[model samples]
Target: MSTARDYGLDEDYEWPRPQEGGWIADDLDELPHLPRRTELIDGSLVFASPQTRFHARTVGLLERALVEQAPDTREVYRNFTVTLNERNRPEPDVVVARAGADTGPKLTRLLPGDVVLAAEVVSEDSVDRDRETKPRKYAAAGIRHFWRVEENDGLPVVYVYELDPATKAYGPVGVFHNRLKLTVPFPIDIDLTAVDRRR
Candidate 1:
């Protein structure tokens, strides 16, 4: 039998099994004191170590840039969970949604339809998920835009993608290094180098 430590899970981590009511978003809400970052993927709990300084810097830089460039009608948030489905609630590094999209008394999760853009910053522990699994799921859920930020030789590189409605897949739009200029969801200009410098 596999143990939590064998899977690099913390001792306090509660593994969700299908037989035991399975894991859902509500379960995450119940555990407000979880030490590590956690997400639900296909009813399985995934735990990740805390972000590195560079990772946090990049996420913050992107959030600030997006907020500054986005129109007031759009909302920009960082480290927010978007409920893709019953068993999948991934907290993206940054997300942009239509203003007033979340109407609950208190903000909970953003449904796929409520999201216009979702962005992820690559981390040592999350390369595959950020590059492959997430894009497929996000596209299948009809998220229009997805951006991935990766580090190359200690500098930030942004890959922009847009979902093709007919195919339900993301097509590469642009790869930016120093500056990012796009006019899809809205006109925006971002200085990629600034993200590194801010560190």
Candidate 2:
């Protein structure tokens, strides 16, 4: 039988052929400079399509809103990786995590316990993953809260979810189209329409 090494398949390729099982998170890190963002889902490599200007703007707006409401002990990060497990390392569009004193130049990855909330701005190429696959993984990992942002009729819609410990699944809190008023992570208000106005 031909081994992966014998096929000259090293981890350096951006997107290698899917193996019999699938690729893991470590294989993703071995690739050279990636032209765009990528993720691993159930050991399968998923490369995100180029984001639209509106999409980028929505992420920035959401990040700023979350940061404004987050306490000093919690920090908001944009486009950072979260290691869900050996086979999944999703780079959520925005992540709210517990703040640590170590501000040194060392690298770090957020585990499930460290994450307070994980949010994804739905993209054209990532609809199913964002809506279905990611939520299942995040809930299984015990992340407290999750949010999905989508553009509808040229407007942003925010969907909120809270984990149900009994089921290891997320239960819908509410869906906000024009404005987001919430008190779970913290009391905050955001005008969802601003994402479209900026474009």
Candidate 3:
């Protein structure tokens, strides 16, 4: 059987570039020179800034939990950039890929089909982006599972989503807390307790 290395992504390509470690603004016409995390919102290049300690811990905890709860069969990613086609580039906090995608560049955009799940850990600046805007965008892409980890209020709250074809808007799969493991429509179920333990 062919391994993930057989996918043929040239690892030699220069992937992530240097930026001052924060979000910088630019017009859409001036995008090619940007580092890996830039996104286009309403047609402008907007940088996705560094995560705060709250943001960092939440993401780290969730990453750990996913590793424990998800099957050893697939790959999970954290704080990575994923392109919504060519125009939009919202970097999700976590994405689950099929097992075969493991041998590629860490900074490359995930094609729509390769993704099994997409997650966002909300910091203050991420509120508008995560809960409001991304649902419309993610649902339109036909993604099977989406999650919003809301940490802005200083407590980790999990919002689960399953895209609904009839509404064309993502509807709540559940609103949950650490008391129960947050289950997903995808092939795996993840523990919400790991991230909520920050309290």
Q: lDDT for every model?
A: 0.83, 0.81, 0.64
Residue runs of model 3 more than 4 Å from their true location after superposition: 1-36, 102-107, 186-199
Q: Model 2, residue 166: what's the lDDT? A: 99
Best by TM-score: 1
| Per-residue C-alpha lDDT of model 3 across residues 1-199, encoded as one tens digit per residue | 3222233324443333434543232222243445445566544455565567777877787677677667765678885555665556566888886766632254455655677788888776668888888778878877778888885356567788887878767888777665335445334454544554654
Worst 10 residues of 2 by lDDT: 1-10
1 against 3, candidate with superior TM-score: 1
Q: Count the backbone clashes (under 3 Å) in each candidate.
A: 0, 0, 0
Candidate 1, residues 110-159: lDDT per residue as tens digits? 88898999999999889999999888889999999999999987678999
lDDT of 3: 0.64
Off by over 4 Å in 1: 1-21, 103-106
Ranking according to lDDT, highest score first: 1, 2, 3
**By TM-score, is 2 or 3 better?**
2
Query: How many clashes does the backbone of model 3 have?
Result: 0
